[model samples]
Target: MNTNRTPNPPRGDGHAHGFLGERAELVSALLALTVYLTGLILELTGNGGPATLPLFVAAYVFGGFFTLREALLTVRRGRFQVDFLMLIAAAGAAAIGKWEEGAVLLVLFSLGHALEGYAMGRARRSIEALGELAPRSALVLRAATPVEVPVEELVVGDTVLVRPHTRVPADGFVASGTGSLDQSAITGESIPVDKQPVADRAAALADPAAVDAGSRVFAGTVNGAGALDVVVTRLARDNTLARVVRMVQEAEERTSPTQRFTDRFQKVFVPGVLALVAVLLGIGALTGEPFADTFYRAMAVLVAASPCALAIATPAAVLSAVGRAARGGVLVKGGAPLEEFGRLRTIAFDKTGTLTEGRPRLTEAEAADGVGPQELLRTALAVQRLSDHPLAQAVVRDAPALLGAAPARSAEPAAVNLRAVIGRGVTAELDGEEVHIGSLAYADSLAGPPVPAALRERTRQLAESGRTTMLVRRGERYLGTLGLMDAPRPDAADTVAELRGLGVTRMVMLSGDDQRVADEVGRAVGMDEVRGGLMPQDKVTEVARLRAAERTAMIGDGVNDAPAMAGATVGVAMGAAGSAVALETADIALMSDDLRRLPFITGLSRRAGRIIRQNLWLSLGIVAVLVPATVMGMGIGPAVLVHEGSTLIVVANALRLLRYPDVREARARR
Candidate 1:
């Protein structure tokens, strides 16, 4: 969730004047302390009288003058804030001749407010740290000379030079350099991305460009070990960093379910407290108690049962929990999303780019005919070297190293004749000899002869086991078979086990891949069910179906997963490799692309929810006990003490949710 607050200019005339004002507040606090001490000394010396009353009054005035002023302003503006309640409680204490109680109430309430302010300030500072990661200026190249300029001065189509170790100034395409880029600041991937000039061209040609020289890069990402000249494609304010800031702000603005319930409860709760105070006063007056005693009792009841503790409990817990989540690389969209996580019974995950590594890998290669194994390997590598598909690249990567020098690099294979049969293989001429690589169907169609029974059976076995088998042939002769598969990520099994331990009972793998691939990966990762060959909308329908059974979370990292992610009870996005739609749509973003964080965040959310419930109960229980006792002739001093103590307990309990040591350690262990 976005924790960013709107930027406000510092509220000081100047640095010196600001310091002076802070000193003045300090002086006021010290003066109030002295007055409180003087009153206590007078009481201890057996001289408690009108003089002591004046000292107590002086303590209240000095400590709470600003609070009272603000309270009055809010009242004039037709708003009733918590400060107004404190002011009323303090004034009532004095009116009841409880000078010590009034002094204590003012001093303690002021201190609590100050402490809350300090905590909020610290939280704001942590959020601001994210904004500071982006550089303020860009080094633009003009006439072959580099000129440093403010980032705001950059525009679309302008070329800027980024040096090693500096944050990229804007979202842009690299013009003429290759390097590694660290996108952890934006996507939370730990590995630095290797970029090349050729890769950049291919990426740019793709609707969404790849990371390479001349490929677009975002602000706040770091360039590693190389200098790059980039053509700015997006203004500074419209870059990925800015979008993150915007998303966070929007998330924060969206009210959580808990907040809505609390707000509705308060609308009735405040009036109920007021009615109870009136009833107590009426009963006391009818009993013929002194007017002063009845008034004191009534006001004490109001102070004892204000429900302020309840007001602060849930929000404080949510704020603290969200802050801790941010530090741990999870962005919970809002308190509602965090609360929903604890209720999840089933989690549906996208297979490609989520449960399994999105990339395909070469698993096995076997010669089918008398053709030598080395010849088949060489032929496969030569043909695949000209293609950029992930499967083709995987095949080339798996080829054995040659004896000495690297194979000659070619822009494209040069051959007298070439043919590509989709879903099968390709045939081409190399040094005037016929060469081919592809599937069995394409090979048999070309040969028009009896198919080899052994090769067909092997291909069937591989296909049934979720492997893509490619047949290589030359002219009318069969060569060999190549096995390719989209393997499960190494960490997938451990992450699934962790989620099970965290109470996720039903885990389903959903993918657009074939059922064979889905079943294979699902079994490896311990998923309870597998649904494959699903389009984006189909995934959404499945998520909705799961939600009917119980609360469901959808975890994914691609455009196809966007709708399903949004439809789940709590959407989790793998920040790294996640499409823009998925990142923006998911309720929570796992910044590090590590599924292990899923269980850790789930544990944290459950713990936070429990803490919130405990705080709510504690605050209500305290009021239930204290209000009745105060009505039964308890003194104002004791009642105020109990009320203030309960508030402190609630605040302290709420703050404990911010202790994230265990959450961090959990992720580390995973």
Candidate 2:
């Protein structure tokens, strides 16, 4: 290892630009500006003549250092870029004894590049901040002894001690201890999530619905109150932060349509401009125009028509918007997705986790004719309290609220002689009678192989409606049936409504869930279409059908959602903190399960597209005016100033996105 110096903090790309590469541009720009101002002031004040020649030459060297290097590198690679055009233009102006005009061109060119670099650097700060959030050293357990080691040295299967109030060392399951974790760093969850040991990796992976705060903890999230022994499931380099950064790096290479167009335009436009400048010079010679003046006009025209502003128009806005989205806990993969997201009028949602709360909740409670509602609920809660099944737990939670005609807190039911049948149901003694609370099958075996006709019908209706049914019986007499369902999230309906208000023409829900369950959720969320009982491939087929007609985005949160996500115009993964597959596969990742981020980012994308168009038109208009004006006797200095000024304006316009409003801020204003 090179021990001479400490490495800079890792950015999204895992490396930073070298000092001379970054500092040379900024420092050179500043130095060039200083020298140019000095010479111009001297000439303007009438205290300068031939004495300012050396100053202008020094200014040119300071400003053109990086530009010259870039020109040479591109030439060596058998290509010409904007830098080559810039270098040639400056040289031509100097050749005609117009050193001041040439200095202005080079100074502005370098300064514009420095500002562009700054914008790009700011765009990367969000991801870099996340990478930097992880601890530098992990307290590893070797032979049960705590040893501090660099996080990079950590490997899979290593155990790390996560002390209370400190950030987690790596992505892993909680092997021991109980506490709450502040996952705001990774998931944007403001509330601290209670956590407990969950060492079964396979079960957690197979059932991500069971993977909650207690099951999987990500690196960078703060541990709360209690210490935890975490088993490292991923290497430091392959943690969630690293994966997000790697994908962002990959996405950067896939630019927007406008950027691609400008790039192609430059390749042909540069050579064509060079040829046209030659024609203009030839025409001037034939007309007996002064040779020095003709060459100067050609150089001015080259600088004016460089198209630098047009080239940066799309990327600046895209990068700024992407960075802004990142700050709001939405990671847009690239320019393509950002632009596509803006134009999206249709989105497909997965039912089980995407639209619903993703966990069991009580939906219905029907008491028998003889039993009071409170008695039925109290007895059911008493029996279910002894069971750990998800449906039972949901009933135990929901029953207390319904004990009254007008739901409010009340007395607890006392149950004794509790017996829990694993993965099935629970039985207990309540009010001196044997009471059972479990699945219909389990209840039938104990209460009635043929229960009350009305009760059975109610149970059947609940099951057919996509609810998990739990029957309550006391002494072979059916008391009531409780319906458990994964209810729609509180924000789901609002999110769909906001999308509609944003001009979304279609809203679809595609799920692997039963047709009834999917339809129920779709109706609850006001979706335009509902396709249920879909396997992963079926979801992909639906997304493809949507793609054939209009731009569609697929939103989901599982390995199953990955393929459909890839099949759509843009794939978005909700609640990505706990799922590596979703994070890697989706084009956009919402760190939290906030449906509101959907509308916020969509609006952001549209705003970015608008700014990109504005920048493009402004840059193109300036170029159109300058090229003709320069050829028709406008001086080199003003032509260079106007051209560079437009590039600055484009960058500034794009920079506005860096301060774009998030949903909360937008709501507050309203």
Candidate 3:
């Protein structure tokens, strides 16, 4: 049960405000520019003494205010930051009686800072948008009537009435009635899913989303034309929408490899710049240069050495790419995973629920010589009703059509005694006759002659076709075998092909199913390697082996897969919209069950990594070129222009990541 409602604040903290909040720095920069222009006109006209000096002074004050605060903060913390260097440069210009030049430098520097803040704000907007999706209040049913309440007040097992076109206020299962839902907030699907009654517990266990009208409804999704009575399954704080918001907020704060590298570089780089400036000043003074000229040249060094662009290079691109990924239905948990995912050399996928849909369906059935297929199905369905195993539900689903009516519990024969053997099968006395259904080993242990060799061969054939087979028996006779298949996702092959196209060096399928079944699924999905009959820990061992050789990513969705997923370099949870555990444990969560997004995410991450490298080089290249020029006698004003211009260019380069198109279109272009 969850208790909290509001998600933690996102990295940027989007708040409603007048233009001041969004553009304070921009406004200040504009004012400084205006004052500088006025001072220039007065100085050029030569009546500049009283009017021009005050205008330049005012311009410096307006523009330097923001920079001064940052510089002061850095100084108080005993740190050398780019802002401190800019402050020293501005003061050096004024000390040399170049007040107008100082004012222009401050104006450009402040403008660049303002623009960077605005660009970062755009990146943070993606997480903030999620905060606005779920409604704050919902109508709850009480005493056979409806009453409105804060979403936080709603608890598990409560019934909530959702009117047409209203956003669902909590995570729950549809209890009654039916409706289509705009589930984009959860699954990122553009179309609505039609709600129907859910199946029994076994079916639901096989695939949590398979329940009929009991289809899971997530908070924040809009209800369609018909009314839906949803039974609250999770409290307000535990809803899928809330978790999405929380994860996004958390992800933004984690540093990427590039960001960490930049931080390390700056620690040495900032102090080194200060030392270089000091050396220049000492050498100029000792060489008998005029104090004004010496100090002016040192100030130029300060302006040229500030690494504003270098400082923001990685964060700008990283933030933009993370936000873009979220909008495309993939939640990259943090900068670490995003960077790691881009370096994937191999991707290991789980078979059931990943490469294939989790739901099993009956594919083939054979009967003993005397019994028809329908009679065998009826007995299997009746026996399965007492259990909810995935294979049992598959048989139950097929029995209704054969029986020409829904299977009724009352119609099932009363069993005098019942027993279920885990991992083997079940035994029961129905209509005073002994009955058994389970794996062939279990059937062989019962009071029956050996199963026909032809029947055994048929079951093996089904397994080769990627199906699970069960043996059925009645009294002393062998009934037959039922083959169940959990088919691969429609897009599984395409996803594999696209990943290979995206430079995925290897693809492996790891499954708990039989080896032959795993091989069939691997072949169908074009997997490069296949390993089967793995227990949960075996999967983890395989993931570890792959990671030891090269970077590896494991994609899975189940409680058992959690450990294996956690062991991989990057863990991707498929169909995360339906599983809370997947949402919490996965390094990356795919909101939709769509496998196609895997390739898309790979491409997006690779593109982001490339852009970060580009930004770093561009920023460093600018410093490399401009610093030497400034030391060789470039003027303070021109150095300021080049330095601040490079800052803007770095920001512009990072903003290109925000143009990340739809995943499908991106893949198509690739």
Candidate 4:
């Protein structure tokens, strides 16, 4: 969101013009003024006089010369566009001695085209701003000193230091430091992630091993309070941000079916109108009507039947909607993607960072006899202090009131017999007593007795509620239990309901977490289906399956979710906590990580699309009404006025999409 990136000013020397090209607005305004003044002078003189004809010719040249040239070139290339129709209609009017009418037509059409171009340019600029999200430079570690270098200069195996408050330069892992990282830019989760060194090998896991470090972190994520020495893995060109830009560019290149259909319709429609006008003139001549009257009427019919309104309708609305979405912090890749959003009947969301907070929190605690909950919490906090596990950290954070001024140091080795059971918990001995902390089943087995009904019920309830339950014991004696939960995001339920209201019929939750956890979250957020315990590849497969069934939208915030996001009909990324891969892979990015905005955007897109269709129909209807009326000996003047006026009305109606009411409401809620 760096809105203040100074625009490159147009150069006066004209060696090369910048994007603005020296205030196109001023040039257009001057042209409009000239046309208006000339029209006024012609009206003050006699309307059908030779003196007014030259002024009309000048106005026509000034207003539509470029359009005419372009249209001719396109026609020669076998691409008969809507612009060609406008040029032909203006030329036909001039040939029939309706010079004033021709000039007015050119002026109106040129103004509409210029306005559409400006709207499209604004949309393109907004999309380009998204390309600026990644930082250009990175701090690389050479020998023992850190050096600032362009991100592209860094390569695989090169050590880079990412300090607190700085974006990670490229995808890599933590080499020798421990700290929290706010990966919201990549993952869309609001919470920060804690990083630790991989502990499987020694030499292979050197204090600064390149391979392991290169496999963990991602670009565009923020390093927190701790410093990390990372090895660059991906090249700048292959980074997530670059991939997203490429995808959007590709999408832009593909034309929508609607646009193609309109083109076909215009080709046939224009020729048919000309034939009808010719037949009408032939009938008038056969019936012995005035020849001049019949010819003028036929020209009117030709002018009126040109599909000017239909041509402007769709593109204008698309430009407006895209602009509105960008201003609201959603980066919709293009008009087609925006249109697809309106058709989304089913939406599948990733669990860790989609429906839930994606961060662990303490949910339950129990105490042993003689050892109060506070005492047990203090010991657990002391032991977990050295670990970077999110669950352990959550427990430590929840019991801060129980911790004394002289906090237990995790750096201090626990009493003898300290051991961590994989996928269970930790165990240690303190003060000559053997302490066991693990799953309820593990503790019950060690205790060698039927578990108490109360403890069993408590454990089952916690487990079913999607909590990670840990049992604390003293040797063969059961002491207490702890429960941790990754709670649902506060707005998750409301967002799901709103999406449903917006015509999203089916919603699914997809996650890498366990089935029970995913199911619990799914129910909480009103998901219609739940798929869990999936790897990155599995997510891609699931999305493919969903696509086979119906058009699907995948919402996620993890590096693991990238493939699935790309595979879905429409992909939405949580901008705040999403991984760089997810952000760059998604078709649309919710920049602020507010899920509520999803429904609002979908609604706006639907409304915009409807308005576009209405404008098209209205434009066609005007042509349909005017063409028949003019061909039956009606005057050319009124027909020309109606045609130009209808085009202006359609263009203005389409532009109304730029100010969607739902966008304002969504922002107000924020």
Candidate 5:
């Protein structure tokens, strides 16, 4: 929740100053307790009168200063904070010659505040831990010599020398190196990812723009066992780690619905409490009770009715959950999304990247009558070699393995006059003959014979099975057709099933791919519906439709899906570590590309929502029982004990979420 208190700046692992510091409040509480105990001991020894009174006075002042200051500040702002009620209760106890009880009240209240601060500090440690991962300085390579420099001084296009076991200095493409890197800080991945040099023309022919294993490294990932010469692609402050830290900090500042409700409740409830105390004092004076007794009873009413537990209920739980979720690689933008995620009834996912590997793989190839398989393979490779599309890469990758030999990379006459038929296919002259390689319609567009019934039937079979068909032709003869499939992720089916297990009643796949391809992928992943061939705006319309019916979340990681994701009840960006826009645009960003994080985050949100409710009810339940009991004459000491005890209970319950088990770990156990 947004508090009047400005958030402390991003801290390192070291302790902060002031009352929020872990050690400061704790030391204050201990000092006050020590003085309080000394006062009790003096009274028991029958040497109490002036000496014990001084000790109690010292105890109250030391233990209650921060709370008293907060109470006064809140009063100056014309509001009644929970501390205001505690301050009044303690003052009334002191006025009634109950210095021992008032001292105890201050000490316990300060101790609770100390413990709560420590707990919240622990929660904020996740973001603080991120700050510690980046090194203050890095080795920059200037003019073929390595010179150590502050990270902030390194600019884009500057080369950096990253040594073995050192953190990557910046986000960049490797100039020369091959090694594994521990990316847990950015992606929450447990295993080290092996990276290779950026693709030369040959490798690009096989897999274009590959992310991992393609020399692209991010800042804060530890380089392993090998050195790298990296060309800095981003400034230090604009690195992936910096953006993650910033997003997390911004997310925590937002207020949840429950927190707002409590804030509003306090605005009314605090003044209501003051009026109730006034009525109690009025009735007691009318009934002829002594002024001291009447004042003591009103103080009891203040302590019993104060909403300390309620005031803290939502923030504690949200901060705890958001922190732990960040550690688990799920970035919840705020308590609003955290609460909305818990209520998500339907989840719409993009087909590629979200459910599938997002790249095509060659699966089947057929040669025409009287055409040998090797000849057909070589011919297809010769035509596809001139293109850079995903299907072309799929063909290029499998050609060598399938043929047991590489295509002839001759100096001349193998293929020439290559041309691209944008989104349709590629054409080239092979061995002094015109050749066409692409979809059936593109082949028809060329100066070629019509496709035979047999070839047409084969294309239909591949399309029906959700595979893209690439037809190869030599002059007027149908050469062959290759089937390419963008395979579903290994975890896709399990993720879909688990999401349903977690009460996601409706799951759909929205894709810009062919209808058959989309439907086949949805069936494999166990989705209830599949909508394919959608333009970007179409996805937005579908998401809006779903949101109008029920709470919906759109999970995507592409430019096309951004609008739709923005239109949903919650936008979940998968593999956000690779995309800065995803991190910024999504309400919930999963650092890793893994689909399983979805169910995990949803489950965690559900647990957080339940905890918030439990805390609220528990807080109000204590008030409902204690307020009337205090009015009916329960002593202030016991009432204070119960009131402060309930506040601690609510905080402790929220802290339990910090230890909530990870979904991946649970799956690993199974």
Candidate 6:
């Protein structure tokens, strides 16, 4: 439901543009390699001299095209870069009459850049493919006749006809049909979900995207066997897929803390390597060693010390992990949260809708001694159905089927002259008798300061067990009591157990529900702490307190949870499919709404961290070994081999995350 308005990506041709740029770089690198090899063959076969020198020069020109371009631009900006250092080393090799070695260096460097670009393109393509999941054109209903139009032309209120086997064109509601949807692409749901028309006119009016989750459908899901008339609630650019793509793009642009540290390291590392190379040349001249051998050794040291592998290590791993998470329906906002997720040890949950199913169910219904149970139930339904309160919805759904229908002698019963008594209950007239349905206190405040001992006892028992009970009265006579409970989610306990397994031992539930009900749910979910009966501001205070003690994460899916989420180190939103507030506010959004994804994302973050540390050490370790060996006696050819070889090895290691398995599966393997 996130509707943050980023400019929509261009339709139809964006992926092609990205593909072509990578292909061009690769072709240039291959051409340089071919030239360098041909020059080598001529020299070894005794066809070498001044005449053949031009061939090696051409090889250097082709090989250094991208490196020289970037190096020149970086120099103009008064900045030092790895590319600039490589260009200087290659030119130094040529000045020392080692033209073949200079050509070899440029060819390998350009080819490494090309091969890495091709590897990184896989991550970029995964994001670009998301924009194309929904069809380009939608069969929009135009005055009862279906006409195909570009998806971008779709606006709110347009009725789109989704035919079987086609992708849904925009996020909308089922206005006139029922069917099943394959939402595996959007929600990672393994089974096709049964969908039907669900009407909530008021919710759709206030925020079309905030409608009930069961009733909503998103773009890019494959339709099942029935035709559906979907009323578009969001514009094309504000759909679920669009928001995900925008967030991923933003994530790649933002640097992580590790990337920032590496950047600072490189600023000093690049300049210092250049100064060391210069000092080596000056010493060789002072000692009167052979100029060619000393100069060649100094150039080799510069190539080895350039920090090429170090520069790409962290970013490569971060990008691969971000792309992998997006494919599994987890949207990480940026690299900062990706890193923070792995380090979180204290996670707080909001109860009402988060830990539980969010829907209240009727568990018990009873009547007084003189009251007919059917009569009591019918009368209660008439009064409760008209109530515009949040708690009344579930009872209204449960009551109609149990009572069947009104008698032939009377019209459909409805409460007239209705008035809500705010927090206490509701008051209205049913067939001219004053009827009320409210808490036990509200009933006691009326009907003689108390109902009956039996009714009070039942109410007390239900409340003690964490079930909410309401009393019904008809003027001066008491009717009956109704008990309801918001049960905990089936997977809540297992998810908490897995989180504990992942090293997050402190799991707390912060709820606005009654203390007793919250405690029951917290225990059911296997949480270590329970803080219930908290207001929105109180939840924020608790989150701030938790943050003071440890790195905290707050997870919820409502507008009220926003403040507490902002206070925590990381704010995670569950079921963010259609809520703009959830999407914009939470640092990470589980697009699928499955609690299992929580552990998956956390595991993925931890795995990415391990890979990043490995990369940094491997790259730094190579630079450590190569710089000293080249200074002592290593030749230019061997130095270039080991240095570029380490760069390739680091890139290959980071790409392993693109295939990281689910946490449960990984544990099974181990």
**Which lDDT tens digits does candidate 1 get at residues 563-639?**
88888888888853224565577788886557767876888898888887887888789888988887887765676
Pitting candidate 2 against candidate 3, the one with the higher TM-score is: 3
Runs of candidate 6 exceeding 4 Å displacement: 1-17, 45-52, 198-206, 366-379, 399-422, 426-436, 448-455, 472-480, 663-670
Candidates in order have lDDT scores of 0.71, 0.79, 0.80, 0.67, 0.82, 0.81
Q: Pick the candidate with the highest TM-score.
A: 5
**Clash-forming residue pairs, model 5:** none
Stretch of 10 with least lDDT, candidate 2 = 1-10
lDDT of each residue in 1-670, candidate 2, tens digit only: 1111112111112212434456667888899999889989999999788878888898899888877876776677676777888889899989888898899989988887776656556655544565677898999999989999999999877889998899998988887898888776666554677888876756754464456655688888888889998878788888876676556555556788777787788789889989989999999999999999999989988888888788778877886787677666677888889998898888989887788877889888888768777777777877777777777788877766776543333456577899887766778898798887778788767634457788889899998888878888888677888888899999899989988888788999987777887777888889989997888889889999999999999998847688888899999999876667777778889977777778888889989989988998998899889888988988877877787778778888988998886665455446
- What TM-score should be assigned to candidate 5? 0.92
Better of 5 and 6 by TM-score: 5
Kindly list the per-residue Cα lDDT of model 4 for residues 1-670, writing each as its tens digit.
Answer: 2232222111011111224622363255348548655765767875635656666777777667556655766667675565666666677777777777667767765665555445445544554554566679988877778889998898877888888778888866666788877654443334566777555324433432233322367677777888787766568787655554444444444444555577678778867876786797799999998775666667667767777677666655665676566545455666667778777798889888678877888767766445577656656665566456777788768757544463546543355556777777777776677776667767766645555567777888889888898876654555567888888999899888888877899998888888998888889889999998988899899999999999899888735577888899988887522244445566777755567668767887788778777887898899879877876655555765676677667667766766676543445446
User: How many angstroms is residue 458 displaced in model 4 relative to the true structure, after the best TM-score fit?
Assistant: 1.8
Tens digits of per-residue lDDT, candidate 6, 163-195, equal 988899999888768899988677766567788
Ranked by lDDT, top first = 5, 6, 3, 2, 1, 4
Error of 4 at 182 (Å): 14
Query: Which pairs of residues have clashing backbones in candidate 3?
Result: 196-212, 196-213, 197-212, 197-213, 198-211, 198-212, 198-213, 199-212
Off by over 4 Å in 5: 1-20, 44-47, 200-213, 404-413, 422-424, 443-450, 665-670
Q: Which residue pairs collide, candidate 1?
A: 1-332, 2-248, 174-214, 424-439, 425-438, 438-471
Better of 1 and 4 by lDDT: 1
As for TM-score, the candidate ahead, 1 or 6, is 6
lDDT accuracy of residue 459 in candidate 1: 84
Q: TM-scores of all models?
A: 0.87, 0.85, 0.88, 0.75, 0.92, 0.89
In TM-score terms, candidate 3 sits at 0.88
